[model samples]
Target chain A: MATVAAKAGEAGIVGAAERLGVPLLTYAAADLAQVAVPNPSAAPLAAVGTPSVAEAAALLGAPGGELVVQKRKSAMATVAVARRRPRGRLALVGLGPGARDLMTPRAVAELRRASVVVGLDQYVDQVRDLLAPGTRVLESGLGAEEERARSAVAQARAGHAVALIGSGDAGVYAMASPALAEAGDDIDVVGVPGVTAALAAAALLGAPLGHDHVSISLSDLHTPWDVIERRVRAAAESDLVVTFYNPRSRGRDWQLPKALSILAGHRAPATPVGVVHAASRPDERAEVTTLAALDVTTVDMVTVVTVGNTASREIAGRMVTPRGYRWQS
Target chain B: MATVAAKAGEAGIVGAAERLGVPLLTYAAADLAQVAVPNPSAAPLAAVGTPSVAEAAALLGAPGGELVVQKRKSAMATVAVARRRPRGRLALVGLGPGARDLMTPRAVAELRRASVVVGLDQYVDQVRDLLAPGTRVLESGLGAEEERARSAVAQARAGHAVALIGSGDAGVYAMASPALAEAGDDIDVVGVPGVTAALAAAALLGAPLGHDHVSISLSDLHTPWDVIERRVRAAAESDLVVTFYNPRSRGRDWQLPKALSILAGHRAPATPVGVVHAASRPDERAEVTTLAALDVTTVDMVTVVTVGNTASREIAGRMVTPRGYRWQS
Candidate 1:
């Protein structure tokens, strides 16, 4: 190690130190593979409650199967050991925020092993280069979700490794549900999350969500406009930190304005609003303004908007959405 | 373009076609940077009713100068071009989910250039070796924020290019705030966002956050405990999607249980809940369960708990937190 420093510069030192840390860390993708439980039938008959805790104990040494489900006052419970190969097989993956560079090693690993890839247009586009020559790609729009679900299920049932790709972390507001809803007893699926846009954009704007905030999407596809609008109003009325996803569409530009009107009712017009578009992508854009000047028209499918809660403070030219951490402490 | 098939395969043609679509793409970084407002003293004046939009334009594109304040319907009256070398600089950066392979080219570029990097002990520790020889490392602990803030300010004012790094995206409950508060007018701070934990975990979970759901932090630190409780209850009551950050602290394990109690009000005991810990890292762990089986005590600082909204559905063994984009068309 000392000789390495003599031969290399600061970058070399960084490389050496990093290598040291890697060895100190215990890593086993296989363990995760084991935890990739697909069908409950094949899963060990572990009780769901305290008895399950004992089962969880037996599998403590395993990888992804350590289910830490915390009931109110109960002790932590671990699920069963993750099997190496479940009867069913499926994968949910995130493509990172707009850029291929931000995709995680895990996501890449899953993609490499996947025989069938299912995802939205943008997500598939980002990782288009990685798909194997004969890899089956399922191009999907927002509609026909059930079809995609059935397709993934059929592929998984056939024992093909499948992956459902989302642009952000798949668990947040994306495919985790539809995939599960569309699945049957015969399939196994594992999730691989990526960077979400709100977080990506918040990083660009100096931590608008550093503390407590509400993240809501202005898009009203499945949700009633009333419900979406009410949620926006509720977030604003509460003075909670807020983030807006799918804030506007060419057909629904007015939604943001009406939502803003609701926000203006409770939030000071000057509430800081951070807008980041194409986050993590080469052409990413970010801007911080107040509720009064939020331009709904400029934001589209690719944009994410974060509005400071009442507690958010603008300090030294940057915005900090206080999580109320200091107060709690 | 024909050879593109050789390079991009099926995805290449799809991407090329998508790029050419006649959609009204909104403004991204390019649009904002186009109008140079040199010397903050001179810049375009924005009209009222859209401060968030216009004020953001001024703050981002205006020359480094003293910000002028203004107030409008959705804008801030006090917006102006800033023209000055920042006395203290803040860079809100996201580290993407772990592996250097996942690091965005832009994110990596900024890290190599940073002179002072401040972040939580875990995050700082993760990237310690990535810094240059002279780069000062400041450990920012979640528990001891004041001390962290002071150090961040002190270092930046010392004229060091600082990288405030965070795991996932820096903006999502990461490093954006401390730098904002500690620095002053002289600091020249900027933000570099990375992948957010939620997104990374979601990717791992296969698009759980695929739709419009509410994101909330279980940590009561920066927020009133009552408020945290309220939001959790409200999110559940509204049958809205919910995510819990800082879900379980060694000292505050009870928060999760309390949250579950409220969430159970809206969701079934079988309502799906996904838990992700140390996502994208070699130590990454993930699983799926329900509100009934959720045990909050098992999670820690590294974990994110996502509770599905009513529309949240599971299919093909994958969970989908539908953002309802399909609801739009």
Candidate 2:
């Protein structure tokens, strides 16, 4: 039980805490005055130098908690109750690769369950119809990933059920990482995995990822070029099938060619490479070509380039990598 | 237009091919007899030394194609048409982490659209209710992945829409690699990516995969232990986060420990390691422990073990790896 310093000595308030077998928490007028409450009145401010005694006291008593009941006035005193630990839910939802059908059922359900939805402007537009009528949408432009993560975490901290949506699997080069970095254990976090771009592109290219693989993002916006080069070299040396995400863009033109050249040092010129652009979307295009024959100009930001390992082959007009080294027909 | 050798010289058959502006390809009785036909008649066999002239001729005319029309007999003749390229769709669908909601809408829709669904008996049972009425299900016991893949391809070759289901993303250490190796360009293949076990486990354990990561299956059933070791060592040297799938089973016990030891060589002993069992399922369990403290006995085949990179940290009981190398709080 909680009460103001002056009310802590009252017989009725003391008896209620004793009967409930809980210690009475008393707050000073200065401490209560610092707390923000929904209901603030002149009566408490004039009498005890606080805008609200009951509401502020309730809030102050439950640290990092939320007010459950508003202030109610009685003949002798005012009362309010606060939940000691109010946990808000933050669901990081992945919408899959472009196509609506590719989105998982759980992702759609999370969108409806959330009272607040946050995502990039384009991703939010994709599932705008899925949200409930009263759900608040917090959307920003493409480069505002950190801002979106902050806003989602802040909303969740304020005790609102929030869903942060991203394209592809949230864990794979998407919003889940940034959002998780900003989020603490104060709120409940649920991760809804979606179909990542690499897998989506692999599907179109006749299972080029049938064997062990590694996914590397070519965009060096956050990561250094040397680190990216080292990872690509490691993948090449290991002979693991490589899936290159963010392979190329108008501004980032040289990375894809440079990365492919590293693989070429270890791989044969005839090595199979599958290039997929905008997989599963209406403008989706998938093509299988040899590493030497590939034209880098056709690649773009949305493209995913999968370079097959040494054992990978192009058979019957489709790229295929056998599951084992000693592959038998 | 196709016809039997005996009927090709006939004025009516020749005129019909001319009117249709197509070449009349005539097959001998022996050639026609070699081709299999669904509707075989004794009358055609006795008259031309072949089972059925129209049906066999149609099938032979379109190589690697399907018979769309059965033989229709009239008083004087029989007519049948074979689709030159009867494209049959083979959708390889990933069911996702043993949860109904984790399965994508496209996976469910493909199950309903398929006239034939082939998968392991257990995976087939997971979505048996989602299949449309009259859908033929060809399910086999475990260790029969090859047989299931063959059966699905055969069904698709015979001009039936087929769906092959697997748990988690089909491309990642699942049925897609084997199935695509067996498939040819004869069928239209569709890859439906699902929530891989690694991503699902990562989601439950916070954002351990906030950076570049690699998924390596520890089971040495098809892959050599040395090859797997090399990949693990490469991942460790590159400072990439690693997710171990097929970590352990009753028969295979040492692989998980060995893989972790490789990562421990490069990562700190206090690095966060997330162990998740049956993620997104009712029996889901997630734990974040340091490398030195993790108990390997608690892991099994259904479990996914993720080892964080050098930059990863445990904050408020959740494992998180910042998105950038030089992360500022």
Candidate 3:
């Protein structure tokens, strides 16, 4: 049971909390003034130092919950109830590979449902049109993932519906992992999946992933190079189709060639490789080449390099991996 | 240049084709009668044994292409131009984990744009509402993937816009491979990537795929059990997060247990395992258990079993694989 500080000692409210076996919570006028209520008036503020006593107190008592009932005025007191949701909602949404049509409908809906939307600046700009009016957007530049994760979690903790957006499927080398690491069971987390770069690139370059495949990110910003290399070697030894994300950047150019060399050690020099840049976007470009023939210099941060397995082939102009080992024509 | 059999040898048309250095192709009335044209007239049927010869010949001439112009008649001759697309377009669309909201806007748009749609009956039913009014749907039951692939390619080869849909990402253990194998350079193919089962299940079960991951389907229908086991072992030995698709079916219950045993060899018994059944659907159910605690009997064809890597942990009842190798509180 909750009430204003002036009514905390009142007999009627105190008796009700005691009878219900619930703790009585009281809120200060200044604190109550911060909460946005559906209805507000001057009478309670002038007489009791708060515009809303019962409603504000109810909301203050239920952290990360919602106000279910409005104030009911009686002759001497007003009563309200706030329903505590099991937890606040935090939707980690994936915007897909930089195209409006490629984004899932659920991702767009979650953006509209959220009271707070957090993402990197460029990614936020991609979906700004989908957000409803009054949606609060907290956007930052690159390398601020940790801060964005914490901010999204905090907003959800405060009972706001929050959406933390990332490009591609949020779980695959994106925001979901970082955000989930910072999040606890205090909030409900819903992951909305999207088209990752590998799938998008594969679509453009035919079906290089028709069989078993592994995706390894080459960025050593968080993970070490040794770990990335070991995974690449395993993928090569096992003859699994490999999709390399974050393959190269201006600062990290050698990794892609070294990784391709490891794949070449296991695969024939002529094994097909598909390189896709900015898939589904207007400037999207895809090429099918051989492992040995690929010029790593043409690659960059946005490029996805897919090396086909032993059973993979180039039919006509598109790279294709047979679904079965028999590999019939 | 195209014309009906009656006008194939016309002096003016022959001279024009010769002057333009283009070969003139003529279609028989029987073949022209088979093609459905936008404009059908009784005058042509009565006079030349086919309705709308100009439109039909143009369509037949540009196999898998549309008639760009309606029939224009002169006193003695009728002419029409059919623009042949470099190739027919075949869009391998992923419907995304059985939820309409999870379906990408591009997937929906592809469904609307397609003149013909081919898929497994259940997947087709999921997107029937999104198809344009006159769209042709070629739906079949399970195990008819080969036929569906052939039909979609044949439609595109004839210059029709086609969409071949699967439940998850079509390139991942779906129709893309078979369709691509049958498809030559004669048609344009677009892959509209969808949220694959692995990504969809990962989202529902926190972030089990936060780090490096590999997806291997356990169904030996197309792949041999030995190949599947080898891939599973590689995934386990490398500590790569693993997502098992087609984990179990009534007739194939043994594979899931065997695959789990392979992972258990390297992973701790308490390693987190997320089992998601029919993710994002009304009957969707997800649970995070340990490697030893997971009940394979609870899994089915529709289920996705994701086993976290060595770096993965169950935090606050959600499975989370840290993005980095170093552990932190």
Candidate 4:
């Protein structure tokens, strides 16, 4: 809220408050000046007769409220969060597809803001330098996602700012599920989206995802093989471009080949298939091949395989799918 | 290549060049010193007899060549690009779902690197301040996607660094399709992936994309309604979460309702649905509702509707779908 309703409306303050389901409370210059804030400014005092609008207003509203978050400014507006007590913060941050620059600014900010970071060992190693000095990092080995989620929630419940990190979007086959499961309304949870492996591989292989597509992880560790195969068959029959995550490992090479065969049943053998390893990483590699010629032995846990739809094509060494429907002129 | 092969290998330069299928050329210090560069340093001259390693090596490798990109230094290395002739450069950048902080660092760098920026007028307005001081912007109104693509490609062909911007991941129903269609081998193209609408909406609504999911655009302006309906049906039957883009507009209000009905056939009426309007924007609004309670009239072109699968649930007012085949023990 602003001194004038028009200012609040034009500045989008009113709409933002409404979206957050919070009331828009405004105070007059004389009234705001009466509340003394820890952080006071001469500029605001001259303009609105108050050194701090956000802190003052929050304190006025919450009787004994404390500043949980100091004033942070963006290009458009200023934000300061206050609460009557210390609230735990949980940030599910996606580090993007292995590349440092691919990570969003919000994800980096969340990592810096957190007092504790919980993640897989490898993912934590990737962004250890990005963390703010003195951040407590709790890293675990692979296949312990649930444990890490529990630990993160526990840390947050202890009144710490916690960031649970994952490669790619944490919501997509990452840490978000277990973390959200362990969390309740007691903590403030924030999800910071990252570039998923499928999207990252698609960029390297060109625009294979230009049309409707589906991403299905090929790992059978959690999902039953029958269920996974059913999805593969459905994608093939539906003519949807398919991106397979956790395509293969030393002990599980057969799943990828089997999935490929299921897809081959519906798609032509000449269909364009993209195999990407460690996309955007130091050892990043990508190739566009056909289902019949791709070597399943070459794939590993770090790889992602994208099978194009019947309408997809490899043009100029890049896979592309037109956006229009097949019959569209 | 470096002064020594070990250095290049240790820095991952050799692997990166090999992955891109480019030759890694090397030059001795004396040979590199023969080439004159715009920026020279005394430190390099004292150590390697060359004032500039990157600029000198690039110039020495391509005889009679000129520097296209000047020497830029990071903490680990220096980079300089030289070509026999001026080569056109094109970067298809995804601006990510709406918030300025949500955009990737790579996407931001591409925008700053480009001499020309081509995008929709509204998207351009969102990032106007982020553009480099002298960037030449070519913004168009609605329904001119093809024109914008052509202009971006043309600018790249004219030997200018061009960035084509779009909301969300540019490859997913955005500018990547048309732009890639217009591009040829003549220009060097780079894709900087952004946070797509589906991912952005998913973040706001919790982990609905925790497992296999599909995104289908509901707009029939170019795609046939029959084709759109088929995808929706496939997602419904496959038990895949469905994210609908261009869900509704004033003119096309029936499609979302029709699509929802099709999804309702496979999922229960109590299935969770997430509706996010202008996600990450100032007017952002998100709600979790049941399929039966969702009002299609409340949706608009700027909205994204995510219909959760049979296993999805609204826990503590947040929509979440487990990744496991069944409920965890």
Candidate 5:
């Protein structure tokens, strides 16, 4: 295995290899001191035998390999990307709820940086104005999530900078999962998280998420009802504020009612529940109700339902879960 | 209680009142039809025999009060803000996890909109350049969090737009709780959520938060250690990925170790743990290691520690928890 070594004191190198899907190779100061590198520093030369651990390791690992990227520095670490060939990039981006203002600057930059953007047709429409003038957009309809993930990875492997976009935090119940499953080490993958639906809904509903919370999808498309029910039960039993994504749709009405019933079993019927549909969007609709009064028919695929814990309070009209111990209240 | 009524079919009025910390008031068409308003519409008159629902409701509720804001139309609904008096505005803002790019545009807008800004001295320095010209900054040192919250609220009450900022999501273990606790319905309060520390750290560590997770603050300054321990125990027993905020400091080093031991009892020693210090800042440091191997000394108050659940895996050096049932993985 190709080995890489850094100053013994440096901590991220081991995890960096794990991120790059490579084995870490460590060398003693005296050993790395002997290897001549293309670029080196006096600090490392003074601390270790080698002037550059990253460059020296690459040279040592692949005797004839070329240094593709010179050392790039982050705040505390230096990364020297080395490969035998050119590499493409894949960025999994979250668009944040539906509002343009909710989108993180980094997510916007990634969308503009990518040569090709892949996402659901509706999501593409949501961010179409933010894309660079010449950017290519490949959009599909719903139920093609797997195909979109595959296409994004394939484009990345073909040396195109591709951004696979989703609404809300992409890593949370979004495209990051499917894309990561299809991705390999041949491409550089970056995940830019967006404001998730749970957080957005919580914000709209006051501070129901002031304390600990969990986000569970009630879609039951890929995840079974039993599994979703178990998670709901766990959250309910733990006094956890729960945010339900994909809470309901035309066909999925019963699932939400069932899940709410499961939660109702654990807490009082008067527990505050917030339902936000199309958060931050033009058609945004949000309301605070009780578990007993929450009408499941009002929810849809675009809605996020937050159920407060036993300690949560309906103050004025807003649902607030205080960040203090119940005893304090 | 004075009653204000809109069309009964309007779906968002109840939720809007809840968000505004007010009670929903309803009036029948005939009742509102009897009142006169500034802007009369034939449509509402024909449909419900009311000239305007919002204006009529405001006029009816506060019989002698003025309509402060004109009726505004959104895509799905019309809103007319009415108040007994001119109120100050308070926005609890999150600066994201140290990176300028991670900050949402709404957060930036809030900074620009605020006539006064309140935050920790260091945090103010981080985003001082982003503030609009003429904005007054009230910066304080650590241990004065309560003081800052009071100052922000006081400033807002004085009729100035105030932004109380904190790193990562302000709502998550930051200033939102304290400030909200100090606030009343007199002033308009808006919470602009940011990329929380846990989410930011999770992104740098790959998809460790792909599944459900809970964030717990290990700092004992405000919360008792027994409460923290019990919460940690609940997380461990629930098999949820736990993200520890305020994980460790020079004097508080023992809490993380003790909490990790509690987690170790429920999970294998090999469970992946991600530690990110000063995430997205110039001094940022991130690493992925097993619970058994994580060195507690490397963590400090600036770090966030995420311990994965039993199903989390170290793939290619990245920590990932699948969103599916155990059988699928």
Candidate 6:
């Protein structure tokens, strides 16, 4: 897996460090050894701009000091941070869509190399050991909107390597928007894709995303109800192999049935839908059910509903939508 | 690299032939024995579904002109023709995307073992003796889509070991489709996914397909134009990183530019679009061009355009769309 190190590493900090011919500082001997001479110059100068009182102390390595200084730029021109890196590398590292081996090697490498890791409380614990010792970590557990952004921005500004991790591909409604909005322009963000739940489900029961497929999220937490409805209508009309994410949660169990109605047009009432829960993770479970037999209340946020394309059928015990080749044959 | 064996081998043909449960016959075999093969009963049978016309009449050793007949069941359970005594099996394969190293080991092994080979004209020519001789060969030239499929199906049905080939994932827009379509359902078709072009392009372009990406083809030769338009509209509205296949041709170059006007509402004109021509194959070229600068006429069928998500951008001559995460100072 070729790392999209981009400006995030090689041409960015490492390049600067190389040009200066100095070793970037690190508490870990591994990171330190990874560089040549320890370049103390890479160290933060005490009067660097944009030091909130708290941060000035941190940058100065002033232990136990918390002064409230105003936020300002860290360095003029030398460190023109993006609004946060437009391509702040994001690795949507899939822990599994269940077993770790199923996790692609690329996902493992990104996790091991990330400097600052930001993610949900669950993911932070999942691959905690992969982190290099002494790396700073910012864990957000159900924080308010601005709080998440503010924390992400502050860390990126700190010059510490940071990774905003998410289970599955972070781009799949898990990390893309919020992470982008918070990190600002100077930081380059890149999303690491993992095996998506739909792919796993398809693989488990033979290829399902074989032909024209569409993945839709049922929970309308952030999206307007009308938007969801319109998209579902459009997908159904297109006869797409649809996968519904965020199918149900506490108090949101009603989402599935409502989704069925919105998609009633194209799919026959008896269309096959595979309800997968805890995909690729321990306690993983999956069941094949038809659209008419689907019981939304039994599902939760962990469940991903895969509704087959118009061609899908229940064969034996599996719900499969042959990618048309079967019919062609 | 996984050899997505043609239907004849994958289902039960190989096993049957190995056990001498069925008869087998092949058209050409210059070197039939260097590799390990499970053998069977009588002479190889006629290839399935294809007419018993040209090849069978001219080359078959059977003095009685016996042709293998298929036992078709339900609409979907059909397989290719069955030989009376099958001596060997051939796997039609596709190595998705490029990066030869990414080729699946299974595909590599099968190719290594093939005594006789058949592939698209360019592929057969490119491999340069990837097969051992005296290997009989059938190279399908351009605009000979049906011809290639028929040849592969015919060869496999005859029971001579062969590997039908495709680049990138076999199941997605590769030889697997036509091979199975024309061959009867009784023929066993096994799909081994190589790296899909989208995944390879995404990996090359620094996580461009992170999060919600869509793989949409601009080709409307076999598919209806209206269907193509609807998918395009939905992908744009959903803000997906769209991968366009067969984006242009001599007569159909207008679709790409037309797609721009249709998708502009959802995607910013300045959004980063990576135009990759002949990905993975030698002479592969990729350019980080923005949608605004894209000239449909300049892009031909060889080109694959990834109209990035809202986050995609051109940075330092490379196309990148950050999944969103900023690193602090």
DockQ list for all candidates: 0.30, 0.60, 0.55, 0.40, 0.28, 0.08
How much is A191 displaced in model 3, in angstroms? 1.1
In order, the Cα lDDT scores of the candidates are 0.64, 0.87, 0.89, 0.85, 0.80, 0.57
Instruction: Report the Cα lDDT for residue B269, model 2.
Output: 98
Q: What are the per-model numbers of colliding residue pairs?
A: 141, 0, 3, 0, 8, 89
C-alpha positional error of residue A190 in candidate 5 after TM-score superposition, expressed in Å? 1.9
Q: Model 1 Cα displacement at A83 (Å)?
A: 20
TM-score to true structure, per model: 0.66, 0.84, 0.80, 0.75, 0.73, 0.57
Error of 2 at A305 (Å): 0.5
User: Candidate 6: DockQ?
Assistant: 0.08
What is the C-alpha lDDT profile of model 6 across A197-238, one tens digit per residue? 665555444345556666666656555566556667767766
4 or 6, which is superior by TM-score?
4
How do the candidates rank by DockQ, highest first?
Answer: 2, 3, 4, 1, 5, 6
Candidate 4 residue pairs in clash (backbone atoms < 3 Å): none
Candidate 2 - CAPRI tier?
Answer: medium
Candidate 1: which stretches are off by over 4 Å? A1-89, A120-123, A138-146, A171-176, A315-317, A325-329, B1-90, B96-109, B140-142, B184-188, B200-207, B250-253, B275-287, B296-302, B312-329
After the best TM-score superposition of candidate 4, give how far the Cα of residue A4 lies from its true spot, in angstroms. Answer: 40
Each prediction's fraction of true contacts recovered: 0.66, 0.68, 0.77, 0.61, 0.41, 0.07
Error of 2 at A278 (Å): 0.3
Query: Which of the numbered candidates is closest to the native, going by highest DockQ?
Result: 2
Ranking by TM-score: 2, 3, 4, 5, 1, 6
lDDT by residue (tens digit), candidate 5, A110-207: 99899999999999998898899999999999888778889999999888899999888888866776677667777898888778888788777777
Off by over 4 Å in 3: A1-87, A327-329, B1-87, B327-329
Task: Tell me which of candidates 3 and 6 scores higher on lDDT.
Answer: 3
Q: How do the residues B87-179 of candidate 3 rate in per-residue lDDT, one tens digit apiece?
A: 689999989999889888888989999999999999988989899999999999988878999999999998899999998899888899999
**How closely does chain A match the true chain A in each prediction, as TM-score?**
0.70, 0.81, 0.78, 0.75, 0.74, 0.68
Interface RMSD of 1: 3.7
User: Is 1 or 5 the stronger prediction by TM-score?
Assistant: 5
- Model 2 segments more than 4 A misplaced: A1-57, A60-78, A81-86, A326-329, B1-88, B326-329
TM-score of chain B of 1: 0.67
Q: For model 4, how does the per-residue alpha-carbon lDDT over A257-314 read when each residue is reduced to its tens digit?
A: 8999999998888899999999999999999999888998878989999999988877
Error of 4 at B313 (Å): 1.3
